[model samples]
Target: MDFGEFVMARTPALLRFAYLLTGDSHLAEDLIQEALVRVHRRWSSIEYQGGPEPYVRKAILNQYLSWRRRRSSAELVLAELPERRDPALGAEQIVERDEMWSLLATLPRAQRAVVVLRYYEDLADQDIALLLDCSPATVRVHAFKALKRLRAALTPTAVAGASHGRA
Candidate 1:
């Protein structure tokens, strides 16, 4: 496939990643469009430099963070977004993902980026550090803290559900 085809094929995944990052579908679409436009404008410049997805990813994150810094409402208005239900997923996984995403939204910008990059994007610590312009150790620490918070938030719910199931 050619460059445009490759980009078209990957745009949905990129938009989904942005959606997960921002939790706003509209903003996610806009961000993806903007990121792709920038990438397209510099495609030749990026094509020779290896995979450009990382560059696009970094640009999206940086743009989001910058917008957050300048805007009054950095948080996405996701109150109306209903959780996606999957029949294949057991109740626990469904609840866990939702709860985890909720807690993730509550985290500070940098911590949220770390968690999203590490888990959602499955990027290595070094990759996340590079994207965030931080050290690998700092990425590890931020990921550690985010996971700790998620664990704390989810554990009680799990325990209560287990107890209720047994009753």
Candidate 2:
């Protein structure tokens, strides 16, 4: 497909991927914009070399991994998330999702990216390692550490104990 068609079809998914990577809507938009601009310039070669989806996705991931993106990184606060709710998800599930997002925000960027790529995108460790420019063992370590933190945060005793310590 042509560039425009490819963009129209993939932008939503791309946006979601970026949002998960950056955890901020505005940053995600900026990532997509920058990635697409570079892709547009190389469209002729990319379209012929391989499918644009994977190429564009790798561009977005690389953009996210770049030093500039990490230079002034900030957490996307829970207050910044929209108030809308999905009808298909129960209230408990929604709360769980919010808690998960908050917990995920606490992770290191590389670990968070590994979690999103492995679970959200369902990519293998080797694929994630290639994307992150690390070894598969490194990717697994990130995933292991991330999941460990998530589990610790999600444990009932931890949550209950945390709340009790608040006041």
Q: Best candidate, TM-score-wise?
A: 2
Query: Which residue runs does candidate 2 get wrong by more than 4 Å?
Result: 47-50, 67-85, 156-167
The C-alpha RMSD of each candidate to the native structure, in angstroms, is: 7.9, 7.0
List model 1 lDDT by residue over 117-146, tens digit each: 887889999888888899999999998888
Which candidate tops lDDT?
2
Q: What are the TM-scores, per candidate, against the unseen true structure?
A: 0.71, 0.77
Candidate 2 colliding pairs: none
State residue 57's C-alpha deviation in candidate 1, in Å.
1.7
The residue ranges of model 1 lying beyond 4 angstroms of the native Cα positions read 1-3, 68-92, 155-167
How far off is residue 74 in model 1, in Å? 21
Superposed by TM-score, candidate 2 places the C-alpha of residue 22 at a distance from the truth, in angstroms, of 1.9
Task: Compose the digit string of candidate 2's lDDT tens values, residues 56-113.
Answer: 8889988887737533354322322333467999899989888888898899888989
**Weakest 10 consecutive residues of candidate 2 by summed lDDT:** 74-83
Q: Compared to the true structure, candidate 1 yields what TM-score?
A: 0.71
